[model samples]
Target chain A: MTTTEPGTAEEPGRAGPSRTQRLVMGGAVLLTVLLVGVIIGMLVRLPGQPPAPPAYDSVDVGFAQDMSIHHTQAVQMAAWERDHTTDPVLRLLATDIEDTQHGQVGRMLGWLELWGAPTMPLSGRYMTWMADAPGHDHREPGSSEPGVTQMPGMATAEELRRLRESTGPEMDVLWLQLMLRHHEGGAPMLAYAADHAQTPQVRNLAAQMLAAQTAESEYLRELLAQRGGTPLPL
Target chain B: MASGKTSKAARRNTPAPLKKNSFPWGTVTAVVVLVAMIAVIGTYVAVRSNEQQARAEALAPFTPTAQNPDPSRAIPGIVIKEYPGGSHVGPDEQVAYTESPPFGGTHDQVWAACNGVVYDTPVRSENLVHSLEHGAVWIAYHPDRVSGEALETLKSKVTVPYTVMSPYPDLDRPISLQSWGHQLKLDDANDPRIDQFIAALRLNPNTHPEPNASCQETTLFDQHNPPPYQPAPTPGTPGARAEDESVDPSRPMQTG
Candidate 1:
């Protein structure tokens, strides 16, 4: 055996670094791993925010519903001209009206279904859905004079009767005149729906209706002028 | 004896019980991390599935199609989703026909036939006829022979100078009273042919009538207008007759 110095010889029980040092190193490694994990987790989570559901209550719903009904009537009157009128161009014009309105009605009904709502909302009043309209003051249901309370541009009972009674060119001219007014009433509501509806589908369909009806209105005006008739004062 | 005693002492001292790590720290940590990831991903999938189910259930009750709301209008709104066309070989064999407005039967049945579309109800038939008159054809039948028969009959019976061909004879609708050179109107109550066509058509209870007063008029069922009004063939003769150009507004055919 050789003589050993007091300090140079290690304690038999101690083999390496002290426990504190080992702990410090392990902790450092753990911290680095945790830090990297957290950064990756944050990056992975960033894109997860969901889109919001379309927000609408009865107002938007009512416009789509009621306006669809209004358009149907207009379609009916236009169809009458398509059949009885001898004019080929007029007949073609009526076809356009029917086709466009058919599409519009379908889309509106689609919205009601999408929203988990009833087809005919149980609202008591007509145009109440438009109550918030700025300065528009649509006629309240059942409030106006008995006769004039008819939806705007709707033909009077007498006028419809006359249209039924007349034949040939007379029927043709009157039908066009009445339909022009009917569409005139529809344009404003279409504009409102376009601007205010909550759903993109609703707004898009409304805009299309507005554009189509407006164009149709122009055509009807020109047609009336050609027939030596004027637009019925709304 | 001294050496033996030293060994015994060494044995009695015993090495400290070797430490056994009862808690597998590394493996436990790995398992915990894996479990956490699974939990998070499972939650995400469940949420997504729930949302999809909600959307599907919401759309389930209302079936959608390209059908017109009014059935009577010419363009019945529904059409066959697909069709293929071939080049025309000759006018006699031509499949293309002029369609009038209120375009109906253009392609296919909306629901029933291989090639027809049906609109929802409330729209009247007169509207459909008017559209047809204006040159809109509701694609009625596929271009196959059986489907082409009605079209051929329509061509022969309704157009002026009626000439019929085989494989598609003129189909007489006693209700329509549509024979060679004449077709019944929706409103004409007096035409024996129309009455007959009506009687035959009644076999199909679903057949809809054109709405309103104009149904009384003598409708030209086929789109072809007469090549100027030729005088009727002299009694008991089959040769050419005189022509009358004047519009006889009063002679509108009445069934009553």
Candidate 2:
């Protein structure tokens, strides 16, 4: 038991607060300082909020995987032209296609690594991610199988064969036709990613691909027209 | 300040009653968690830095190979013929040549100055022999390979004789061979024929496509053409193979 004065009881302790009161006040100050320090540290450490965690199953991933496949075929076709065509302009274009697409493929693989995702998704149905997209028919209009039709402008086996067999001006014209269609197919995917991807890096890359492909597509159209051909109706 | 005083007093007392309020368990717990989180982040960064350093170290050995220089550098002087027919370049005279094709003068002519006299020849295998006979070291942008039979013929025809100082060897880059044909900076330029060969070797099938008689002219870069007509002239310096010794003339041309 300790001595207590009547006025001191009201005051809590002699000129100072009691041990309990002091402990409570000190604890409160310490708690505030720690909380503030933590918040400041974290805020300082935060890196632009890290472009919100990418959606695991997203339009962005689908676009990257599918477009990579598309670009691979384009590269293969371009390589064929480069090796076989005698036309200087066509050979130059083929080389450009091969070098640029190979670089883009590298970028996509890098993104997949950073996202901790597989290069391709475990989807039985390709392009199902775009079901909600209006005016985005991927098949011959009124086809029943939904996403079964080759996604817009893809060449069939026979078309690739014809490309390989023909040479000279005929080959150049056919290659330009097929490539222009392939770009048309690819443009929508890029546009979707540009509008919807969570990462600014992803969106910016998509926009760049869009601009480049669109310009190339226009050039192809002009090349075809110069050779007395027109773009095939989708 | 209060907490410091209370804790001190509690330590001094034999048995202190439990304080109504002491250290804030919530604040202490939060500070501990934050510190742990920061530690984890620091460790992650350090590990990543080490991995990058290790990767750079492992890729050091596979760099590309360099081009080999001409190794033959010895020859003896014998005789030389002057232009319009033949004359001798004295032992003290020099050779000056270029890759430029001959139009009016010997643009592609092989010329030598020896004993204060000048000798000139078309850049033919026969001329190469004449230059060597003058004790001149022959260098060409593109040295043509003479066939084994042709080399023998050249060896027999050479009048006042010398030796091959720097004979053509295999090269790694085809472009280097073709490009070198354009360079005429070395003393071998002292020969007049080398300038003619340089001009002839510049023809490209794509640029002109139709092969001209002049276009068939040879240079060292044209490895596919043929072997040296005779064994390469033996090096004349000490510690070198004897002049009677011979090099294989049928070695396969290295395809770049």
Candidate 3:
């Protein structure tokens, strides 16, 4: 009886685990696996990691695309005036505009390339991103075509032709008139981008453009007054 | 010892009955947590895939492929040709080009200033062809055929850095868009294909000979007073093909 009793007691003690113990162990293992997975996911998304690229329709991208095109025209006109102007003051100003605007264009294009975005506006329209801003209309008056809205303050083919063909005082006065209006037109775009762009670099660039253009506008106004020329209506 | 054994057995049996009567709250909690985790992960995966699909769908039509070498080919009425690049003709000479307002072949040494310029006068075909080599889209309109609001509508399509618009005298079509070896002739400025043509071929590395070539005028070719357009010289004209070389149509020009 004694040997049988001892054997029975040992059998129950040696049995692996109770049903409840097995269930709890299995649950612990699964919980550990999930916890590890979540930790890894968090690490991957850490702020120290490189941020995701800007979205295609993001303010940073749209501003860069539109501003690059705007700067291109400014560079073109400045380059021409730089080469053709006899007045030292106008020549200096033209050179400055050409060099600065061209460099800005290169910077914007580089960003677009890195972001895998099209350098040209995908919609083939200008300033569409600014439509949501208060008191802004991105469309030109009577522009019926979907993708052919002319950017504000752009010199017409006739005006550019006249600037190219004119000489002496007439050329200088016309150039100042056109460029002053161009700067005035571009100021609002810069201000909007400066205030609302998502990327820090883009915002800084826009802010810099506003400051430089503001100073340049003052100079242009003085030069126009000296030349007895009035600014063109925007 | 027997009494002790009996007491231990009685204690184990007592707890077993109590455990069975009580609800298995721990097991229920574990199952619920596991189900919630799976649900969260599944939702995250689904959202990520949907976003990727939308982006792919947006870009697929415009993306170039080996089979569909030029995406613009899908547009109705687009004319595709194969032309050799880097062949230069002198300022005074001209190529007996197969196509009028030629898209490619034996261009002038200097490329007309593109960079979104809209020339009021007709620009030289040879120079504009050189611009094509540099990946510029030349929008040519017959002065008599397109005017007034139509002309203004056309001019607005020209965008900076790689687009040019000019009058092409004696153009067979009202509007012709030339980009390297590609051409799309259109009757209406409002045609959607015009935008499609520009989006597909302007600076398209696959379509143009010189992908790195500049659109800016680096040489003495004046933008305001660019060379006037002249008729292609008649076949067998002396010095017409003097500097022309046999370029491989399949090969892209080497960037200098």
Candidate 4:
């Protein structure tokens, strides 16, 4: 039923008129081919150009935002511990955490700022990306998984106020407890990002962070025990 | 049958006028296709142009604000940042800078003493960047690559105030001369262009954001022991590349 005969009826003289029609058709096809070649050339060169960098909601982006804010609290609490603790080991550890975490904070913020992504996700939407895993959102415990709704292990405003206003051994104990919980809360995000971040650098940073925080958490628990402190219930 | 006969007569009478009207449709079809082709070609050209434009901006963030804006007349140095920046950094804080042996970006509150001091060890990057903001020139060399006569030749160039010389392990070039908004990498100890670069950009005022600011000051950091150069253990980061004398600037050096 599909045939080239529809246009054949319109051709009056096969020799003269058909030749002219064929020439016009050839010209149009050639023009289209030339135009298509230009499109292909542009596409072939596209990957070589660096992308506009990460956007606000991308995994690499969301990880940087969440971790930067997460690290800020650690630095702050470490400073609190530095001010409150008298134990030489605890003081040294606080100082170490303060120094290195502040530096890492600087690096992370530097990357986010350079990438033009927000330093933190807009309020309320934090860690919602973790919703990707099934059934765990309910099983995650505390606010979502560790404690509180903002992020895993994040101290509530009331808790931060308490940590800030408290003094002496109480302050030391509070600082240690809060920091330990914070690290534990941060674990899921880091673990997720380590396996799933789009950028190699993001993955590399997550790996470094996982190792460092793991070691620090172990040290944190040991110090808590040395002070005859028990781990806070999640 | 009578209507068909009358229509056939009308068709015969108006054949030339009808043919003329039909010719315009063929022209219109060709016109439509040509317009479509132009649109596609235009879109591709625009995207390609935009990509090149973005790359060009990324390649040179800081342009030479020399008294003369002529590129050829400008001192020969690769563009570092394709953008201009002036962010203030805290004196004690660590800045994750975009360039190693930074030319200019956010810098610490205090400037390093550029009062004709030739440091034997590498100075803190924060202070060095601050000094550049005050319109001083910094000459950084690899400790292993340039020494003895080459070292002396470089030092002689830094005898005046607002100039300082030190070792920078991260530099891919053996020596790089930096003033505010400009830097030139020299393979040889005695490139005549070295002097030209200094004379053109140093305290040029046109390039310096604060030309009147003093370079003679010091605080916190010791005169003798500048922070030791330590490369980051993480490979491919700027800190990791700090210890290696990465030779080609064209190759991706650490950005943050």
Instruction: Report the number of clashing residue pairs per model.
Output: 47, 39, 0, 8
TM-scores of the candidates are 0.40, 0.43, 0.71, 0.44
Q: Which regions in candidate 2 have their CA more than 4 angstroms from the true location? A: A1-15, A18-28, A36-47, A137-149, B1-256
lDDT tens readout by residue for model 1, A82-148: 7678888889988788777756766765665455343332222345556567776676555652111
- Tens-digit lDDT track of model 1 for B74-186: 22122211111111121111112122111222211011110011222112222333322222222111123323444443332221111111111122221122111113322
* Alpha-carbon runs more than 4 Å astray in model 3: A1-14, A17-44, A122-125, A135-148, B1-47, B59-87, B96-101, B118-122, B141-153, B159-161, B167-175, B185-190, B203-219, B222-225, B230-238, B241-256
Tell me the DockQ of each model, to 2 decimals: 0.04, 0.02, 0.20, 0.04
**Angstrom error at residue B216, model 1:** 17
Local accuracy of candidate 4 as per-residue lDDT tens digits, A2-32 = 2223334234523243665668767877877
| Preferred candidate (lDDT higher): 1 or 3 | 3
Q: Give the winner by TM-score: 2 or 3.
A: 3
Most accurate candidate by DockQ: 3
Question: Which has the higher TM-score value, candidate number 3 or candidate number 4?
Answer: 3
Off by over 4 Å in 4: A1-37, A45-47, A135-148, B1-36, B43-256
Which residue pairs clash in candidate 4?
A140-A145, B60-B81, B60-B82, B61-B81, B61-B82, B61-B83, B62-B81, B172-B246
Best by TM-score: 3
Compose the digit string of candidate 4's lDDT tens values, residues B6-31: 45446567553464456457647876
**Each prediction's whole-model lDDT (CA):** 0.43, 0.46, 0.78, 0.66
Give the TM-score (vs. native) of candidate 1.
Answer: 0.40
What is the lDDT, from 0 to 100, of the residue B206 in candidate 4?
A: 55
> What TM-score does candidate 3 reach?
0.71
The per-residue C-alpha lDDT of model 3 at residue A6 equals 36
Q: Interface root-mean-square deviation for each candidate? A: 18.8, 21.5, 7.3, 16.4
